[model samples]
Target: MRAARYLRLGEAYISAARGVLAAPDFEQVRLPFYGLLGHGMELALKSVAARTGWDDERLMWLGHDLDWAWRVTLSDAGFEVHGARAVGGVIRQLSRPHHAQAFRYPALLTWPLPDPRCALAAAEAYLTLVRDRHG
Candidate 1:
């Protein structure tokens, strides 16, 4: 299923980010790390939508809007996800056009990137919440 595919891909991106962070020239790869992180979050949100019975068209409607997807998933699930508020805040920050756009193209945006470790923690927490609730 698409949800499973997204979840797996998200996990892979998180792993890739970790690998980059462990390398000697970590500074050079900051953009790629955040890019992977943002993409992972996007995929994770889509996975949630799929879990909620959204078809492919509805999933595509979600597009790269993490904030909207996060809100809709939480509302539809009707449960408080651990670290959801904090993660949602990250999602909102990343959802801004420039920030999200940065993931795809070179941009001169100056927004602060969330700490990779903290971001991973939040993602894992949120993913766990989704699994516990849906699986």
Candidate 2:
């Protein structure tokens, strides 16, 4: 259920993050963060599942819109990860030694925009929130 929650949040965040990126000023940059959010969700899902022992199929059965749920959660948390490089960077950031223990949703408010590195940071917050509340 926790994993499902994160996935849903991730899906929702990606859409809003993309909207921010596509805003008049950011339109020129056109970073395309939705893809990055999806990638981040995929990576986070796999990683969290592997670590938590929730198989892919089991997670799939959690809900049909889990991806959307993840997106919404991330958006509510204010994470704005977008792009492949940004996604990778975020994952790396989250993978760092302290993230699993220290990252939090408020961190997203200060989270740098247009940086893929923030994806992992977002993931850490999502996972931590779910784990803390449900685990």
Candidate 3:
């Protein structure tokens, strides 16, 4: 039940991110866009982790570390996450020390932001894979 809820929340966050990314002036909103994308992917990874027998406490402890979640989820299946390189890149970008804070605050982001559409597509693919394998 908790896993299901996490998955649903992940989907919702992705959906909201997609909507924001679809706006005309998305360049002006890069912070929220990437922040939401990173967070959504984190939740999606947590959902996969939960399906692989992670407890709620463990998920919370893992908190906001998309790289760890990604590794754990892929390792649980003993395979690479297919069709998600763009999303993976974004996760790597967000997982750097204090990167989330830098993104949330007004710091100069030196890293290139992935195209929202491409990132979202890869994220959706990952979520679909998780659903198919775990559901």
Q: Clashes in each model (backbone N, CA, C under 3 Å)?
A: 0, 21, 0
- Model 2: weakest 10-residue lDDT segment is 97-106
Ranking by TM-score: 1, 3, 2
* Tens digits of per-residue lDDT for model 3, 24-116: 998898678777777778888888778778898988988777788777777874646666676677677666622356557887777766666
Could you tell me the C-alpha RMSD of candidate 1 in Å?
1.9
Cα error, candidate 2, residue 8 (Å): 0.4
* lDDT per model vs. reference: 0.74, 0.44, 0.75
Worst 10 residues of 3 by lDDT: 94-103
User: Lowest lDDT 10-mer window, candidate 1?
Assistant: 96-105
Model 2, 1-135: lDDT tens per residue? 555555556556554555655567754433334344444455444334433555567655533333443444344444334443443445443332122222222223232333443553455454454445444
Candidate 2: global Cα-lDDT?
0.44
Evaluated at residue 82, the lDDT of candidate 3 is 66
Give me the runs in candidate 2 sitting further than 4 Å from their true place: 27-47, 50-87, 93-135
Tens digit per residue, CA lDDT, model 1, 58-117: 888877777787788778756577666778777777676423677567778677666767
Runs in model 3 with CA error above 4 Å?
A: 77-80, 84-86, 97-99
User: By TM-score, how accurate is candidate 1?
Assistant: 0.86
Give the TM-scores of the predictions, in the order they appear: 0.86, 0.31, 0.85
- Of 1 and 3, which scores higher on lDDT? 3
